[model samples]
Target: MMKYILGIAALLFFSCGNKEDILLPKADRTIVKEVMDLSPIYIFFRVNGKDTLAEVNRKNSISTTNWILNIDKRLPLRLVIPEVMKLQEKRRGDSAHKNEAAQNYYSYADSIGKNLAFIPFTNVHYKMVKPKAEVIVFFDKSNKIWVNGLMIKNDKFKNFINEFIDKKSENYQFCFSEDLSFGNYIQYEIYLQSLKINNGQEFIN
Candidate 1:
């Protein structure tokens, strides 16, 4: 699925859909892991509040070759020790002609895995997105994964509750408190003005 890139923001947003189209889909923990496994490594750059969500893989895509969205200070946050600089930096790794620095970052993130016990979950605040508040989400994979969600109280995450996860539909894992949103993991990519959030119930897409 290595596609070409040009315009920074290339996200495919969904909105103004039928009720059936807006149903919250559940992502099996295993499938969620697979989503990362199947795709190329993803990286994000945050400088001057501008974000560039890019993608790469062990195969074709690499470096800035596959930029998903060249966002200027949008989306959520990451727990990088040092803040991401605005200007793009070319480390020695970039000299490999394959963006080795990014590859290394992917390797490190992959090594950590999503298992909190093996590696603590790192989160970034979704401050720039809708609802205004800094929405924090768990991102522990080599590639950054995003999902549109329905806001619900009680921290309810998955629409379809699993055995290990909390059974309550209202209580999700991503929610900091009762203010949880159901991410349409099986849905589409996040795009500015590309989608709609409906009272945390069902979004346009």
Candidate 2:
């Protein structure tokens, strides 16, 4: 099933004239934990805006060769998931030899019968593509949205996103209050899906 998904992604990669980069979809929680256990270095993501990945890596002497992700479980899935994707992007190599470090990252993913490549779920199969323009979306506890730091009514979300889409805006940064409930978060996720918004980074206050 994993291969099938990746194969489809590869086809999409080519079909789109290689315009977009293919990313490994999110892995199961258990699998992620197992990979972390086997890894020598751990890269942790915190909600506080203190530590950047580069800082942590440099401080720990973490080489790109071996490291696993560690995100706080208390963080909402909506907020943290996109950061994980971004982390994968940060760790990726140049388009020519991107998967060079795959072996160190995904050996454990392979042993679990995933039949994935050296860096399973590590975006090893896809080429790298940089994001276009960035659109900032912030939501308060009341679910009110602010676009590019300007406040807008909730009903205007679709219109705002559609306008951006027309302008070829492919990247979004989603920021929301930490007090939001999982149910509220899912609603926004579904709404975004309905709007055909697929590529974005997320943050929680």
The TM-score values for the models, in the order shown, are 0.19, 0.36
Per-residue alpha-carbon lDDT of candidate 2 for residues 1-205, written as tens digits (9 for 90 to 100): 0111233112111222333222222221222233332333222334347632211222332333455432222334445444444656556634554445443342112223443232234432221222223676776667788777689888877887777654345466566666554335545654564565655445665
lDDT of 1 at 116: 8
Candidate 1 wrong stretches, greater than 4 Å: 1-29, 35-41, 49-59, 62-74, 77-152, 155-205
lDDT of each: 0.24, 0.43
Each candidate's clash count: 19, 0
Which regions of candidate 2 are displaced past 4 Å? 1-133, 166-171
lDDT of 1 by residue, 1-205 (tens): 3332222222222224411111122222221121121122223332455543322122433454422211212222332211222212322235556432231111111112332011111112222223322232332222232222433322343332233233333232232211222132112122111222211221111
Model 1, C-alpha of 199: deviation from truth (Å): 16
